[model samples]
Target: MTNAEHISEIATLDNVVSPDKVRLLQLLQTQKAAFLAEPYPSYRSRIDDLKRLKAAILASKETLLSALEKDFHYRSHDESLLGDIFSSLSSIDYATKHLRQWMKPQKRHVGVVFQPAKAEVLYQPRGVVGIISPWNYPVFLTIGPLVAAIAAGNRAMIKVSEFTPHTNTVLRHLLGEVFSQDKVCVVHGETDVAQAFSSLPFDHLLFTGSTQVGRHVMKAASENLVSVTLELGGKSPVIIDNNISLDAAVSRFIYGKTMNAGQTCVAPDYIYCPKNRVDELVDAIKTRYLAMYPSIDGCNKRTRVINHRQYTRLQGYLEEASNLGANVIPLGDVASDETSCFMPLTLITGADQSMAVMREEIFGPILPIVAYDNIEQVIASINENSRPLGLYIQSHDKAFQNKVLRETHAGGVCINDAAFHVVVDDLPFGGIGESGMGSYHGVEGFRTFSHAKSLFKRGRICFSDMLFPPYGKKIHDLFYRFFIR
Candidate 1:
């Protein structure tokens, strides 16, 4: 079927949005009340919840893939399964396995001055978390945070991207089958609805999208004093050491940049290649992409840009870069088919920051290559941009990897690899500066959604009365003499 036909098949699914602002507010209020009713869910209950979620996701796998295909025009089932479906299931399993320990109160040591008192930290759920997910990986982004919230025993209301309404519809049905609206609600809406969602009072808000929109979400959340976890995107870069083989680097790098047609947030936005090996690197990328898919046509592996708006935006980047005399090389045997909104993997060599492709996050199948003479120059250039979500070092030299890891700042780092750290489940995934703020995955995710409440109890032997006086006395003097120094 053609991409447009697939979109037309699911066109009716887009109408599943909340009717008005009142309904959106009502959903939040309902979730808040539900959270208040069951403020702390037991470990066993949370495990059961996670199990049910996992099962439902598995059952709805095909439906979700179809909806995503309709939404993106040509996303492969494997892409959705690996990134959204299986990844979400993995998160649920990880959370389920650890919830027992995560829910336990941690004992803390008391100071000598504060002796005879017991202290512990209780993980309390932050009520009514708001999850604003993006279109790029809608299911995983929404469900990922929801997993953390559920693990922490918090209710959540999700505001999904309008660009993926078909997927939103599938999610709404799936989550609704497992949870009441009060516990977990999927909210789909337009711009005004999104504005209202961002403005609502939430205990915590987690937004995943561009840095520009994150600023707005943060600002709107500030009015309610809502603590936020902003998973924003930036220009993530890869540095290939001069000592490394270009083929080895290409093998590791191509997987990340081409996966999901390079519509990944942590996809290598740009690469730092050895100055003498730029052409070789470009050829390696093209050869590797073709090896993955011989031709864009007839192969179902290709994914299209979400819509006309994004297609136009990405096209403008290529157009502007080409106009500036940059070499815009399109890989594969076939040229991009605009009718399907499909753009083949293209590389922009000798691209500087003057081009929009380099300046902005290229959330498409476009990579810009920066040839570097020295490692320090690459580090300096990366520093000039805002911190990225992920930094990749495609080098075997431990010293080189350590130097880059020690000096550069990013949300996460993958040595001799790229972008796969997000699926590790145990590790915390997030960004720094423009990339994002705060992380959520496994134990870190559980903690992000939970409030660590400190509990202290006094022992029977209370000696504080002796030191309570209007002025300094013998007991106060004794206390001061023993501890003041």
Candidate 2:
């Protein structure tokens, strides 16, 4: 091949790879090269990155809040501060605090047969991690995994949700302030760019979104055999055991469901309460929720549904449930304002598995309550569906809580509460089965973006030469006879 045709020939190029794909490929190559140049970032360097991340988040706090409001229609500033800003800052602090310990090689026990050799695991950085963050908690989801990637000494490229154009711009600015494009790149476009981005060969890809789209992302990543940590959403259930007070249980789990107006992945999708106490539960929920969200007040501090499409989706859930004979209870003075896209926390009773509300993941402020006769029914009913990202058990009875914990499966469990598990730094936030595949929060987050490479080193003396002969000797026979057992 001469210099003229060294790069490629027009006829030789794959037509399937579009210009958008070409740009993504080039970006991947650039990041991969940068990663190769500094494959393993040192402790000091990673700390510097974390520190810079913290500072940049603080510096861009106002802009981030404004961007979130613009994108979310009317996202609460406090919600953004807690979920997006503070959560990311907390993750950076956690990674910074624990990175030194996490980076240190872990020692492993050596068997008696291999006494002269030492075994350990080195946390190796898998180059060029790709993060596809959702619009719900854009900044946190993007920066959370990025903290892990940086802590693990890996380069990254983030593809934010297209629904969040304003927030995306702010994110690009926030990240740009901290690192160069090669070290940390931010890309955004419609679904086509997202598809092309996922199809790229990455060391690892972390995506936080709906379960349906999660499947597509996983399949696209599989094309390159890329590892993925999908933080997919599903129907997370909240159980109200007889031991706890009705009002108390509502207070704990209702906060989780209504915080992002039930737009949270781990929000309590439905409640499982005693059949006899269903009315009491409803009363408790109404009283508790109305206190927090009195009225629409024209969408002030009220988190509207992200857009009209989601607003209509939530409305459809209510309509279908009502048509199926489920009692739809709208709580606030103004239950919903379509123009504002603000839908108050509504409750559904007599819901069954057949309804779409129960079938799909309701990412809006709709809550469904299912009455059960006993704990067994609740556990059995929950098992019938796919595993969720989070599970909430409200009970003071130790045995009751233990039984629910052992009987059911979820990515994370919140005792007497909900959605708080995912926000914690130490806990591993992920899904099981249909909900999602992998987790990333703190140490788990660090490990998710890292390659745990096992290393074995020999001492001055050699242990293998004794057994490396053409024929088996008496020593080998004795060693095998003794060690085999």
Candidate 3:
């Protein structure tokens, strides 16, 4: 079926969102507000709900894997189970274990001037949230935010990507089996329906996708002035300093770049290495790729581009690089058939900033090498473009790593690793500037969907009478002593 037809089929599954479901969500929000008013539910309850979600996912693992494989013809079952299923399940477990302390009201000290008043931060759910997930890593992208929204005690509407119709259908079915549609409803539609979905004045909206589309989603939400958390993509860089262990650096670098066929937001789009060490890193990466996927021609674990559209797009970048005098090195042998399911793992060297491969995000099994003579030049080059979602550095030297960390302004950084930074539940995951805005995951995720209301309880002291009179020396002195310190 055509993409549009598939989207229409899914949207027609349930012609209209039931009014009863909407009312149920409203009632849940009211109940949550009441619960917040009184003694809040112990963190244990929130954690338990996460546990339930995890159990539901685990029970449906096989079903989900099959659906995803069918959706993306070349998706690796093992890769899906590990990258998407395992990571999301682990995140849920982590959030469940740590959610109690995260939900507690944090006390903020009132200044000496406001002696009698006590101030504290009360985190309250922002009614209902809308989560719009992308096709890449469909399982994690959908459930990860749902875990946080549930933990924050907010009702959520999840919009599954239309590109992956099989996965979206399976997800809607699985979620329906696990929870009431009112609490968490999974909607599937095309770009137009998605545009309509974003226009809804949700309490908060969390969107994970490309930077260009993220802007449009934000604009749609602007009509409602709805708060948004965007996890967008950019040309995330991996910098290899001269002082690191080449062996470890190469392994992590290739592993990250090739995982999921480079369809990751945090994938190292390109690398900036010293001119002297450029050849060494390149050779190491090539050697590692051969060893890992011995026969890339029919490697089951090596995923393919999702569809012809993506394949064509990536092919265009490769063609542009070649036409622009960039050296395109095909690391693995391409299958005999030009339109075969597998595309060869590629690495381009002697690539300049002007080349399409280096200028745009190559979301495929392609890595570009850009050599730099000076560290300062590399840093300046990175800073010149839009801030990326992630910046990875491989340097055993503490000082050099610190310099990159401090100098670069990315959404997140990993000292000696690549995409693993997002695995940490405590740290926030999102982008900055053109990459994205706002963050989510763990406590940050909860906060993204919540309003941190500041509550102050003041006793009736009537000390302001001293300032009621017109400006005078005595009144000024009283004001200075009582308020201005």
Residue pair clashes in candidate 3 = none
RMSD of 2: 2.6
Off by over 4 Å in 2: 1-14, 296-298
Error of 3 at 461 (Å): 5.4
Residue 305's lDDT within candidate 2 is 91
Looking at candidate 1, the ten consecutive residues that score lowest on lDDT are 3-12
By TM-score rank, best first, the candidates go 2, 1, 3
Residue lDDT tens for model 1, 1-485 = 53234323333343444456557666776676677678888888788888999999999999999999999988988889899998999999888888889899999998978778889999999988999999989899989999999989888999999999899999999999999889998888888888878877788999999999999999988976889999988999999998888888899978898888788999999999989999999888888888888863454567788888888899999999999989999988777777788888899887887899988899998998998899999888888879999999999999999999988999999988899999999999999998999999999999999999999989789776777767678888888899999
Question: Please, what is the whole-model Cα lDDT of each candidate in the order they appear?
Answer: 0.87, 0.89, 0.79
In model 3, where do residues sit more than 4 Å from their true spots? 1-45, 334-340, 460-476, 481-485
User: CA RMSD for every model?
Assistant: 7.3, 2.6, 6.1
Best by lDDT: 2
| Model 1 accuracy (lDDT, Cα) | 0.87
Model 3, span 221-310: residue lDDT tens: 897688898899999999988777777898877777878888899999998888898878878887888888887345556677788788
Listed in order, each prediction's TM-score against the native is 0.94, 0.96, 0.89
